[model samples]
Target chain A: MDRRSFLRTSAVVAAGIAAIAAGLAPLRDLKNFESVEEFLQKHYKELTPEEMKQALERISREVERQYGLRPHVRDLKPMDGVEFAYALNLTRCIGCRKCVHACVAENNQSRNPEIQYIRVLKMPNGTLDMEKGDHNYATESVPEKGFFYMPVQCHQCHNPPCVKVCPVEATWQESDGITVIDYDWCIGCRYCEAACPYWARRFNFTEPSIPRDQVNPNMAYLGNRPRHQGVMEKCHFCIQRTREGKYPACLEVCPTGARKFGNVLDPNSEISQILKNKRVFVLKEEVGTLPRFFYYFDV
Target chain B: MIKNYFRFLLRCARIALVGDWRYHLWLGWLAVICLLGLNAWCKQLVHGLIITGMSDQVSWGVYIANFTFLVGVAAAAVMLVIPVYVYKNKELHDLVIFGELLAVSAIIMCLLFVTVDLGRPDRFWHMIPVIGKFNFPGSMLSWDVIVLNGYLILNLHICGYLLYTQYQGRAPSKWFYIPFVFVGIVWAVSIHTVTAFLYVGLGGRPFWNSAIVGPRFLASAFTAGPALIILALQIIRRTTDYHVTDRALLTLRSIVQVSMLVNVFLLLNEVFKEFYTGDLHASSARYLFLGLHGHHALVPWIWTAIAFNLISMTLLLLPLSRSLRWLDLACVLAIVGIWIEKGMGLVVPGFVPTPLGELVEYTPTLNETLICLGIWAFGLMCYTIFLRMSVPILQGKLSKANETPGEINRVCPAIQSRTATST
Candidate 1:
């Protein structure tokens, strides 16, 4: 092509991009509508009861049309008033894996026989236990021993490293101190998986292996929805259930009442009382993770 | 004459199949079957990573280790290139193309290994575009992508120009030769350094956070890469009419001797920092070399690596071994031992007791092993095709290279349009 035509074509492409940028950048300051922040910041859960019911119906219809199957989709998940917190009694945890099972059923994770959010480690008590723990342990029985349980999951750190390392900005911390992942946006690079000191992040290697009847009907859009293959997922502090003032199933089912769930900000809440009466601590204090969940000896 | 023509046709077919066509074909078929096996593993995409031997406890595994090893192979080829192309050593000059081609193959393998380790492959394009997803500036991921892609382009450009000139029966342009030499050296160093940065900057993994990691990687890469090139050349020497003198081979041995010495010295420096003080930081190396909690899995492999390196260094260092026929055999042994030792021995031990204080053993899955073999076969296949394409150019027989770079710029229809468009 001639130079004049080449220059003209290049200018036309540049103008097309400029037009799109002009349209979107000023849409933030819409006088005809509300502000972009005002539009986006309205928590989906804060919608009117009628609006939430409409969303549920829309999603159920969409799922059936797309998958040729009906998936339970409900948005009774209220978010205006309630907050979530979790506390663990260090002295009571026996590494029974019951909490792990309770999480699988309650959170509606795939019954692949191995997936679990909580990992109770048989950490050696006292001595220089600097760097020795087994992650791939297949010991079926919880042996009676001089071992302390270090229940590990996402710390929901105030300065979360996983969030900073995400190339796609797919993971973020919320106002309620819960860290959540955008399952659709996550590329499964596992850079965050490496960045996390806690090893809490898990990758979807294939489609989740849930039987059709067992799949959870009530789903959160960004929280615990059936994740796509090759994305990262982790504990979201059971955000979907906790947003509605309901206890996480794992906390509800704990036989020893070992788990305590409440809001940390409320001075009169059970976790706040537990923090005052008991010497509670978060793991990896040296790394400055500032964990929301705490473990205490005599809560 | 007809019989000769048929024989020539058969040889070309074999050349298309690459070296030891029957053997290469057998391995190639085996690799194809392994892709079917990968389908079974692919079923775990959503089942969560629970499908693999890897768990929340043993978060990273065989995939990462192979990534590290393949990077070493890619970086190693520069050892051959720099001496020949930059220094213009007459003995090594003719062999530089082989190194460049070898590097191109290794880089492709490195990329494939990284892909295999991903939780999802469909979202790979998330790293592309001039926009949102692939955070380029501050990320080690961006550094990896840039340096790797840049080196591949640089080498292919150099490879094509060299062949093109030889085909046209012309001496190479001063313009092409000068820039290629400068970039070749930088490109050689960049592959391993970027790979080292992947681990070294991670402050959490105590095993990988050493400052000397970059230097150590380069030292191993330079030594092993040349050893691989030399071994490959020896096979080509036996099978084909291409020939190099004994003295030229001896010069290569000396380069390896110096490289191995530097590599071992660096290892000693790393070991000294780990053991000099009785600190807890010293334990990761100790755990790898001596069994931690009585698990001595990597011991035999590391020891064999040490022995082969020592034997190869001895032969290279000694004047008598340089002349001995068995010296070549020793070189082959050292190269194989180092490839395994670097690939598994370095990678697995570094992550043994992970940052979370989890010690999970890693044995490559059968699919991972088979796919790795397939990658190697594919690389060899590429080499054969490249050589067939390259041989005529190298021997000064192609039509394209007769014109000067300036002449091609002036008269070529494509170049005229490109320059006109720029105007």
Candidate 2:
């Protein structure tokens, strides 16, 4: 080779080496290495049954190690011919916000940054306008004289914009009508967060900080599992509980018994009954999300 | 043949590496900025996006805004390519290469902005088409991934091939690059349109849902991209031995003038619709232009952008201020105005008074700003290196004639004949 070409080759090689060194320098952090297994984990749907069992065990071990609770984290699959749906009674809701805290506690959400899935908006009595609803309403007593309460959470739409916007299929709508995110798989671009009309999704900006004492031992692969930093999380209709034929913690904890959950495929279920009997409406109905979550007032 | 191609690349690399002290100094400064950005990014990686000013309310802040703006810049390269290639405008033929180089750098910056914005950038492999489950065809973002990467590759191929031929002192084979150039012209429109689709397809963000968004993006991109080329070419002429024709600059100026006029007209059309209708959908625009309730943080910014755009348009349209100084100022104004209009005004305001009607103002933190500046510095560095290598080839200073006589005669017969006839 000529001197010019040799010199050029040397310079290019040096620069390439420097760039590779610089790029890989960040990965040298031991903490990054600690999550190597997590990093290589397959997509939730792509996991084999054997791989899934191992994943669940790993998740359980991680939660146990982190929270000092031996959580029974299971990969709950959707049942045949069952589509989940939810309804909330506006007239019965007292703006107590017990459901909000219950969701946080049950979901094993971060305590310090306070990632709560439920938002209870206190609306002025005379208007159905959501814009006028106040989320930070701090009063001595709820059900204040001229006010009504509306608690909004994930609507779990059949045609979910959140599912469609994810560049990676990290988030998707399960066949059971619940939207789920595989925390390990999500790149946390938050496109889904931006796309959700109800602002239902929450991102773990930092490693979620729940007190060891406050951790719920029961967890599910798609629901209340301990999530790492840099992933998206949202309400999955309390998949752990609901999949086991129990109510979501929000419904169980509501003082007014305002929340209802059931399989929509079962015509006799409470959600179907509410849809039939009540003047029900979904939030941002014009957005055409076709939300499984319904809201209604008593006659 | 392969060995010869490799040698050609090495020679090009040699040209890229060899530079004056001033060039080294500029590159050093850029490297320092990039290092600072990398340091800040390391901190962000450790601490997570909580370090950013972004919250769940305004989930996307400055990084996304910059990404959106740079996509426009990258797509704007096609404006030059269209006239030169399609219209057969010889005056702009030499200048189109510079535009393509700018595109390469801008796209690199666009990709960097996106990477830094990702909460789990390490998991980026998940977006790969086959191995990873890329939600393509259905997701606008997936479509974006495809188009942006595709456009980058197309421009790289075109620029690399042309520059290599020029370096060999050979006339480029039309059959090899003509089809790609035509594809690039259409692909340029697609890149920006897909970016616009990324915003407009969101049924949630009312401000971005307008049908006019895609056209508005093109109008602004066409104006801003060419204006940047004009400024860069002027700087190149002043600092280097490169000869950028005045006619080329004038043609670019006319493109900017026409595109800026259309851009402003489209902005007005959007304004009229939003303000006249006075509906709930108009609230985001109201928040942007006039501020909603008591929060008006973005009002002054958007108005200033409007003023800059108007003044720049005026300068470009009038024949009185056609001097170099005035033209440079107009180009600067257009670039900054379009940056703010497309970025802070467009992306942020869409999330302000968010879909749920909560007004949470977003402002980029110092870390965010540094990261942005670092990305810009990186793009500038890439553009500088590209121009440094390509300009010498275009000027015929680093041609095959400089090589051994045997090598030149064997490898570049077309180049020898072209050079011999021209000389």
Candidate 3:
């Protein structure tokens, strides 16, 4: 070959090598072959029953390794004839933020960055204007004078904009009314966070910092199961506890019995009774998210 | 024929690789900045987006802002393509390729910005079709992903085929390229429209929900894109032997003047709607313009953008200031003004009052700023390399078959001799 052709061939070969090297550079951070498995894992819905079992077992093992707790991670499918719903009595709620803490403890939320699903807004009496509400109020007492408390969490909407805007369908409303996220499947574009009117979704900006002692051993594949950094997460109505005929931790921890939780499908359920008797309203009804969560006044 | 094509590419690569001291200096500076950015990105990957100035309150920041602005820049290429091909404007026909090149680079930057802004860029394959379920038709973001990628591919094809044919000293087939060029014009509008929809479709963010957002994006894009081209042409004329005619620059100026005027009018219309309506939804606008409840972090920045835009528009409106020096200054102003108008001024305020009505301020961290600068440098490098390669073919220096290897050295002696001296 002439000098020119040789040089041309070498240049082409060099560029090809560089391109391949650049492409494979990101794979170095994948750690080992196990991460390759994690990367190539199918979407939660697309997984076979065998794959699902393996995934749950893998996640359980991962949680045990990371958080020093043998988490009972299971893929909790929706129960037959049970559609979960939540209601909060504004009169009883005193802006104590007890439910927020309870949620963190139950759901294994990151403590350092402080990822709390619930946001308790303190607004003045006779104002439905959410803009007038203060989320960062630091008062010493419970429910300062004329102010009322509204603790906001994922409504698990029937027609969730969050689910609709998820570019990967990583998040979706379950058959049982609880909107769920396949944490492993999310690309973390934060479109769902933007779409949610209530700002109920939280993004894992960093690795979650659950204290070893505080790590909740009970976990759900669709709920809190030791989330990795760079994924979208939010309230899943404590799916780990809820599917097995128990109230969400937030409901259990309420001091004044302000929070009520049950199946809206059953007429005998507490949420149903509240919907029938109380003048209950979902926040941002105009947005038409059709939240399963409702708020009411005892009067 | 294939050997000839390979030879043509090698010649172009040689031209791209070799440059004078000034070019080396500029490239070295860009390389340093890129290295720094890569370092910062590594730290971000390790620590997560927590290193960013963005918070739960402000989920997006400078990276997304830059992405939004660059999408407008990329979309601006159609302005040249439409006038030249449809209206038979010969003055702009020579320069249309430059605009296309700009689109390619801008779209690349847009894609890069989006990639860096992602929380899990490693999981990007999750958005792919079939292998990963893309929520197409349903998600505006999915639509954006499709259009942006499609536009990039379309431009690459058009530019590649045209430039390749030029290098081969043959006429590009109209059947192959013309239909695609028309498709590109429509596709350009779709990219910016879809990007705007990414914001406007969010019913929660009232600031971006305005009907005027899509139009505003188009107006500002048309203004910024051509304004950038005018500046690029001036630099090319000064530094290289490329013959960018004054008439071409003047034509671009006219496009800029009209678009800037429309952009300003749209801004006024948006301002009137927000301030006059006096609703709770206007809270974000109030915070942007007049500041809300004493939190006025973005107030100065928005007003500065408005002032720069108006000043540039006023300059362009006058016939006397249409001289090269004044026109160049106006173009620079228009480019910066639209960048601020669209970038931080537009993206940040949508999340300022946030959906929950909190007033947490967000300023990009040093790491974010460096990364942004690095991306800009990388884009410039790409543009420079593309121009270096194409300009020779356009000049008919490298396309002649009889030209020997020794003749290639004589044709562009500065690069060829520099290579010899360095080695």
- The lDDT of model 2 is 0.88
DockQ for all models, in order? 0.21, 0.56, 0.46
lDDT of 3 by residue, A1-299 (tens): 58997899799678656744553354456332236668888898899999999888888777777777787878889999999889999999999999999999999899988999999999999998888899899987887999999999898888898988889899988889888888778887887887888889898898888789999888788887888888889999999999999889999999999999999899998789999999999888888888899999998
Error of 2 at A117 (Å): 0.5
Q: Is the docking of candidate 2 incorrect, acceptable, medium or high quality?
A: medium
Write the residue-wise lDDT of candidate 1 on B40-65 in tens digits.
33433324344556554455566666
CA-based DockQ, model 2: 0.56
Please write out the lDDT profile of model 3 over residues B1-423, one tens digit for every residue.
Answer: 554565567677777867899987887677667666766776677778888998888889999999999999999999899999999999889888888999999989998898888888878998999888999899998999999999999998898888888877789999999999999999999999999998898888889988999999999999999999899988888888989889988988899999999999999999999989888889888988899888998888888888889889999999955799999889888888889889888888888787777788899999899889879988998898888888877888757554465855755666556656766
Residue pairs with backbone overlap in model 2: B169-B415
Which candidate number has the best DockQ?
Answer: 2
Better of 1 and 2 by lDDT: 2
Interface RMS for model 1: 13.0
Ranking by DockQ: 2, 3, 1
Q: For model 3, what is the error of residue B144's alpha carbon versus the real structure, in angstroms, after optimal superposition?
A: 1.0
By summed lDDT, which 10 consecutive residues of candidate 2 chain A come out lowest? Answer: A26-35
